[model samples]
Target: MKIDIQKDWGKIKSHFRTCNRRNMHVVISSVDSDQMPTVTPIGSLFLNDDQTGFYFEKFATKLRKSSEQNKNICVLAVNSRKWFWLKALFKGKFSDYPGVKLYGELGEKRDATPREYRAFQRRVQSTKRLKGYHYLWKDMAQIREIKFTKAEKINLGKMTKEL
Candidate 1:
């Protein structure tokens, strides 16, 4: 289903937030020059209020390369919460979509703003006490922006009729 990005932006953000809260990785898809598709699991994608988003560019080498070759990208965020699925199954329908696909074009890579950096830090604060947190997330000082073009609700046949 086609979604008005401006009107339904809040829902889109909610979907991402739900997935992020569960520590689920958002999947980003891009095609290389040869038309082969590459999918990357990203944990740092953040949606802005104006239908644009950014992801910390620390270890996404393949994603960055593919995006440079082809700016078009599709991001998929699935709720994947057990309670959400169980409730939907019992009702035979979903109150909201289980997932959403965001179509967008990648923008330039730039140093992240202090606000953005702090936001990222806050998101991963719970893991700060772990040693890997510094090794993995400390250098995520750069970000790549994405200007969304469209939003599509992922339909699951009759399971999504109520949505």
Candidate 2:
């Protein structure tokens, strides 16, 4: 069964935790009513205590904060990749620990501790076997909300239809 975006916060958080298996989430973005949806692949999602807001590390994104344009977006997460369609949903809000569409604003983000920042940078350094990999980490474009529906919501259905 599918759950409403605002009513299924805990279920959505648990789906991303990968408590018993590999976990990953995909982020979707649409700037306007008529704009096309933007999808991003992510490996990590930070769910805070109390099931408030969540955070993820992204290297680059199509939307930047300087534009002042509202980025209507939704994030889809899954607990296991084995199940092609685990679960996902639409979301909005922007603040620290906000249950709804309130994941803090975009652009105005603080950097990890100087030491931690350096470590992240180093972890992204190029390797002999792999070159030209994107090694940048930036604050998530102020996410608005997250939904916990079948992964098919974004993949099999019209969740990403071009507007």
TM-score of 1: 0.96
Off by over 4 Å in 2: 1-8, 19-23, 32-34, 54-58, 65-67, 83-108, 113-163
Local distance difference test, candidate 2: 0.37
Candidate 2, residues 1-163, lDDT tens digits: the string is 2344345555545554542135424444435333544555544334433433333335435544321465334454433343332232322221111111222233333434554444334444443245334332432233222222222222232433321
**Top model number, lDDT:** 1
lDDT of 1: 0.91
TM-score attained by model 2:
0.43
- Candidate 1, residues 58-163, lDDT tens digits: the string is 8888888888679999999988889989998998888888989999999999999999999999998889989999899877889999999999998888888666
Quick one: best TM-score, which candidate?
1
TM-score per candidate: 0.96, 0.43
Candidate 2 residue 157 Cα shift, in angstroms, is 12
